[model samples]
Target: MQAVPNAFSVLSHPSLDHSGGGRASSEVPRPATLFESAELLKGGKIVGIMHNGSLYRLQATKLGKLILTK
Candidate 1:
């Protein structure tokens, strides 16, 4: 099976070069990783996530929405 990415990136504005006086146009950032909820749950209704030594639960509701709780 393919390994899942540990982190996902969100779209961010162009980075600013503090000393360069303009946006760092030459430094292209890596594209964000995307994952489908079905892939994450693996055909299950719920999944557990461990973050910073704490447990988080991701649940899919009957209404086709998702919720995360600590």
Candidate 2:
């Protein structure tokens, strides 16, 4: 008999749609530090890519990927 490979599902596409149509917003008014981001991540919040030095969160899904709200 042949062994079957395990299947997997992508939780989030880090490149494709982390922004979520640019609708998400940032809770932090000022620039967030790495430690802050870590805290957010620990709370199950997606950490968006830093662009021009800013952090944001997903507004729609509430559990989706992060985006540059600023």
Candidate 3:
């Protein structure tokens, strides 16, 4: 275990010096209506989310609902 450092010790670690002032490049963010685009969805109710060589399926149901499966 390690002891906690004071506020002055915060910058002791290396940093990328992002001009965005600490926004992570790897952070994936999107708007709530991201899948609302007809072109991306291709006029279908399904879309695939690829992660680590795996495909996740997102489907819009006939009841106007959503379902996700791996």
Candidate 4:
């Protein structure tokens, strides 16, 4: 039988530096909640979960178009 690969492993990469004072020249306007979600999606490195009356972000890879659960 073949062994299954671990999913909790994390790989690190070098940081990116932008010379234009951190802001891009062409930026699109977005909703505050959506902008926050996108930032959380990028920086959080995990998926967001909702439980009860509040929302929580968790660490898990997304699979296709299926719904995610914690």
TM-score for each of the candidates: 0.59, 0.20, 0.42, 0.22
Candidates in order have lDDT scores of: 0.73, 0.41, 0.58, 0.40
Give the range of the ten consecutive residues with the poorest summed lDDT in model 1. 7-16
Q: Pick the winner on TM-score between candidates 1 and 2.
A: 1
How would you encode candidate 3's per-residue C-alpha lDDT over 1-70 as one tens digit per residue? 2333442233322254344556434554332222243554677999998989999998878887878899
- In candidate 3, clashing pairs total 0
* Candidate 1 ranges with C-alpha deviation above 4 Å: 1-28
With a 3 Å backbone cut-off (N, CA, C), the pairs that clash in candidate 4 are: 49-56
Order the numbered candidates by TM-score, best leading: 1, 3, 4, 2
Cα deviation of 52 in candidate 2 (Å)? 0.7
Considering lDDT, where higher is better, how would the candidates rank from best to worst?
A: 1, 3, 2, 4
> Cα miss at 4, model 1 (Å)?
17
* Candidate 2: residue pairs that collide: none
Highest TM-score against the true fold, candidate: 1
Worst 10 residues of 4 by lDDT: 7-16
For lDDT, the strongest prediction is: 1
> Mind giving the per-residue lDDT tens digits that candidate 2 earns over 10-39?
222233335567433344233222233335
lDDT tens digits, residues 1-70, model 4?
2322431121111122144454432553232221233444665456766789777655434542323454
